[model samples]
Target chain A: MEREVNAYKCRKCGTLHYPFRMVCKNCRANDYFEFDIEPLPKRGKLLTFTFIHNLPAQFEVARLGLGIVELENGIRVTGQVDIEDPTLGMDVVGNVEVVRHDTYDDRYGFVFRAA
Target chain B: MRDVYIIGIGITTFTRLEYPLSEIAAYASMGALKDAGVTDVDYVLVANMGSARINNQSALASAVVDTLSLTPAGAVRIENGPASGASAIKEGFMAVASGMHDTVLVVGAERMREVNNLEATDFVATLTHPMAEYIYGVTLPGHAAMFTRLYMEKYGVTERHLAMVGVKNQNNAMLNKDAHLHQKITMDGILDSPEAFTNNPWVAEPIRFFDCCPVSDGGAALILASKEVAEASGKPMIRITGIGQATDTLAVHERPEPTDLMAVRIAAQRAYEMAGITAADIDVAELHDAFTILEIAESEEVGFFEKGTGHLALERGETAIDGKMPINPSGGLKGKGHPVGATGVAQVHEIVVQLRGDAGERQVKDARTGLACNFGGFGNNVVVSTYARED
Candidate 1:
């Protein structure tokens, strides 16, 4: 099965949200678990990107490329950009991947690459 | 609401101090109390960020109050990310303005140097959205770098502009006796020299070493009182005429426009409205320039310049100590050092000193009105305060 990033859709308003929230931002009327899980678009345009040499201790690499991408549906998400050379508004594609590891478990998020 | 005035102010050197966190806080408070010629306050608010995590201390307010022997006064610890200091002051203002407390001692202190560099960065990053930004290994500098890229693209702000702010503030720190980075920095040495690359390497792309603030341990204290108490003290009436605070979305990606800091804009607007003054009325300002780019961005957001034109003003030497609009004359967070919790209060401390004409070398001439903007948590929360000195 192919892995994909998930976004939450408000059942009442059809408003999509990333990382899931208890209430719909648009409608503001949501009960517990009153949202549907929807897969986020893998294709997007890199809005802004940064190569950071300073990372948390968990990230052992010398430098990490990160960016905010505007998806095809107009939703923006922060993700790790694997593209060696990233330009603003450049087309990109992403997949659900392990971004970091805590003391015991791995965390999964979108990792983008040049399209 | 009744008016609130700053009767006394004190601060320890914004550098690493080999003292306990509570002592750091108490030391500053003592100076404030001495300056006010009062040994007691009706309340105490301690602002700190990393005492529990880095310094292995907790219930910080209790310790500080006890150390200062201001016991039995209502005490609370305020943790509002980097804006903790000003947030604490805001509460103090409310207490006094509402006639609940006659006098409130607000102290902003931090001991971030107790931990190593990576550890300090990690702790600060904890303020970011957990599942979204933090798990992805996002740090503040990382966020600033990404934001800087966008601002540069949209507003034409360059690396040179960022370096100019760095050089200006760091050199300004040389005049600030209590500032952290007292060493003088020049554009030539940091940017134009042959070995400038190594001298100012990129910590985050587009954010070089000089672009960021040093992690220091220090404290700043302010005593807020009513008009009666302030007038009785016989000091320059540095009244906090305007106070405004606003919060943005916790996740930066959630904002409608990534480049716009709606919180800062809204907060400053509210402050200007409350004070019944425009940006032009402000004679001096101390902005939260944790990063160099922030100085320029906030200058625009706080209505100092037209949007996208702050850097142009900087190039015209408009933000210098004697310029039309002086900014970060105390070196700001960039050079004075960012003791997290202490920064917001320290910014106000500089404004108070400036308004009173106590800042000898870096005083803005004939400064009567001043402003301080304390930003928190990647622009998610911010506080803007305006003050006036009535002689």
Candidate 2:
């Protein structure tokens, strides 16, 4: 077992949302900011990915792999891809780890690998 | 609503400039004012994205107004990421259309070249979701490249099709004197030949250097006037017939169908409805091709072609300057240069040039009606417009 990234579920509609928002998208007929914290399932399938050779100034790498992954719980999230040869629809498991190293500190995000 | 007409237009060369951001905007504003034969405007709207962050300049509209000696005029800068140009014009359109102002000057300018390549890339990357995408170091190219992978598989599109778009837009740019990157690139050199790897290296896999628009520094201006003021200006009556805008999920991965540009579709439909016309009625167009694939993808999204069939239209030579319904004759953002703030206004500038039959060698034949698509962010925020020659 490892540390988990959280997804907020609407208390009213039971809809799941990541990178939480002010209002619930599915059903807003309930109290504001009423959401349940749920641990996101890490096992998923790779959707689409790219190996970016042109990177931002912050990333200290010749190239970086990034992708959108569909989690086992049906939540899709963008994460760093560490897989050597990631094909679309391939099984992947995510781990919460440091994805960026800023001047101040390291930023934690999902990093995916072949399951 | 009162009729709003484009009485005058102006633009600076789409290339690196050694001028200040305010000066660049003022320079274009002066050109537009002189074109309209007016010394003063009722209101001023400046469209800029990175003036403060990249150029270390803030209150851009105030700076430009004072620099042009247009003091005491109410002004503000409209920033909508890459769609700032069209968004400013949209505001200017409202000002005049609502009878609040008789004449409004809208200018879109940016000096992204003021910073180093790394900083500029990060600046543009700010459009993505910070917690979800940016923390993953997800740049715009990376986002587009991932979307392109889905497109290639779902629609049977290939690298050759992507290269064709790059070839057409870049070559079309040579005809535009104001466009950046005047160098001629061929398919053999960029895609087919052994030296292709050296010539068009990957910026993001599936997207080569040629596929992405160059980081440009430039400005474009437009003068929107009420019918009475426009009649006095004596320019070809180019009426603003339609304006439509829509937004989707800010994060690209959040959308149910990742490759589907729902905002583009919805925005264009609204625009067409406002103009009382359909896609087939458009004689010419300027689509936001920040990346080559966008031109193809947006064509379908905007109803010019069926979904996933835009590439087929490209293969049929239907999107060329001489082909049926020519798109991006001014080289689009791909060739013309994409100064984030200026791109939307520059798109309209080209369309107006076409509708007025003043586009010279790049003009679409009998272009009585034209459309411009100003895309913001990664298909999240979009503004689509329709323009017509009204005698």
- What are the models' TM-scores? 0.99, 0.99
Which residue pairs overlap in candidate 1's backbone? none
Scored against the native two-chain complex, candidate 1 gets a DockQ of 0.87
lDDT string, candidate 1, B232-331, tens digits: 9997899999999999999998899988999999999999999999999999999999999899999999999999999999999999999999999999
- Candidate 2 residue-wise lDDT, B1-391, digit = tens: 9999998889999999998999989888888888888999989999999988999888889999999998888999999999899999999999999999999999999999999887899999998898989989999889889988999999998888988988899888999999987878888988999999898999988888988999999999999999999998899999999999999999888898998999999999999999999999999889999888899999999999999999999999999999997989998888889999999999998988898899898878899999999999999999999999999
Clashes of 1: 0
In candidate 1, stretches whose alpha carbon ends up further than 4 angstroms from where it belongs are none
Indicate the worst ten consecutive residues by lDDT in candidate 2 chain B.
Answer: B180-189
Best by lDDT: 1
Per-residue lDDT over A4-36 for candidate 1, one digit per residue giving the tens place of the 0 to 100 score: 778999999899998678998889974899999
Off by over 4 Å in 2: none
Candidate 1 lDDT for residue B4 = 91
Model 1 - which docking category?
A: high
> What lDDT is reached at residue B39 by model 1?
86
What C-alpha lDDT do the candidate models reach, one value each?
0.93, 0.91
